[model samples]
Target: MEDSIRRFFARYEQFFLRALAGEPDPAEVAGLYAEEFIAASPAGVKAGKNDASLIEAMRQGHAQYRAIGTRDMRVRGLRLSPIDEMHCVAHVAWRATYLRADLPETVIDFEVHYLMQQRQDGPRVFGWISGDETAVLRRHGVL
Candidate 1:
């Protein structure tokens, strides 16, 4: 069960990284998220009742950047506690080196908590909240 959970998160991370690098079509990436997906960050909250809106928002977010790249993306400390047979509360830490066209390379280290539920297809993210953005910005001298 733990292995399965890890695999699910690994796939999600791969898709997320690919999207961040502008590698996949938005529609394809949206398939990874559940219908009631929400992502919370330091900037604001984004939610989608359905896949279309979620995909559109993701596309817009990708478009907002002139150029963005990532290196050494990793997920650590992935621990899952069951809410039920089909759902779990997930806690994990993420670290990545971010490269943007206008700024020097910056390392982002954050922890994320997620509500994940299993679907007929697989496990999908229902919602997630991330922390440590301010620290990342300070590291880059943005703050």
Candidate 2:
């Protein structure tokens, strides 16, 4: 079960990297999210009620940046508890270095918390609230 959880996270991380690199199709990314997933970040809320809405919401947010890059992504902590036979609740802490086009090579060290539901297919990231957004914005003089 631990191995499966690790694999799930690893796959999700790869999808994120691909998204940042402009590789995956929007539908591909949206498919990983649950139908009722709701993700909140410093930017805004993304209520994924359907694949098209979710993809559009994500694209709109990504459009704010000319480019996005991430490195040194690591899982700081993970706790998974069973919610049912087919689902589990996952609380995860992740750390990474984020770079955006507007930052002019400035790197933002970020730590984010994710509340997810581990389904039979994979983990659905329903909640994401970054803890380092304020500091990152301040460092970049955006705040």
Candidate 3:
């Protein structure tokens, strides 16, 4: 079961990488999301279960990037803390670098706390809260 969660997360990481690279397959991106997945980022609330809205969001985001890149997408820290087999939080550390046509090369760090939902079948990210303590640390290369 633990292995299952790990695999799901690995797949999620790959999906992000693919999206950043501007080659996300609609089906692959769709599969990781639940029918009512909601991710609250700095941008705003994005909620969708179907493919159209999600794909549109992805497309719009891709259009904004001259080059959006990611690296060190590691599970720097993870805990099944306050352990509930069905739900847990993940502390994911990642670096995102971007170079827009209008802007200079900017490397921003991110630490996202994903309120992940685990099922008997596998794990699916249900919701998220960004900009945590680790995010500040990562922004300055402190983590």
| Winning model by TM-score | 1
The parts of candidate 3 lying over 4 Å away from their true place are: 41-47, 66-83, 99-105, 132-143
Give the per-residue lDDT digits (tens) of candidate 3, residues 1-143: 45666677778767766666667778876666666877776667766674688778766765454233233234444444434867777766656565445445556655776766777666777777675534554464434
How does residue 38 of candidate 2 score in lDDT?
A: 60
lDDT of 1 by residue, 25-137 (tens): 76656665677777788778977775566677767765543244454467866988889888887898777676656657777677788888887777777888886566665
Tell me the deviation in Å of residue 84 in model 2: 5.4
Clash counts for the predictions, in order: 0, 0, 0
Candidate 2, 1-143: lDDT as tens digits = 55666677777677665655656477666656666766677578765575676777666545433234443345667777665654565666666555555544454444555556666776666666555465675766544
Q: What's model 1's TM-score?
A: 0.75
lDDT of 2 at 21: 60
Of candidates 3 and 1, the better by lDDT? 1
Give lDDT per model, in order: 0.71, 0.60, 0.62
Candidate order by lDDT, highest to lowest?
Answer: 1, 3, 2
Q: What is candidate 2's local distance difference test score?
A: 0.60
Better of 1 and 2 by lDDT: 1
Clashing pairs in model 1, backbone N/Cα/C closer than 3 A:
none
Query: Which residue ranges in model 1 land beyond 4 Å of their true spot?
Result: 39-47, 64-72, 100-104, 132-135
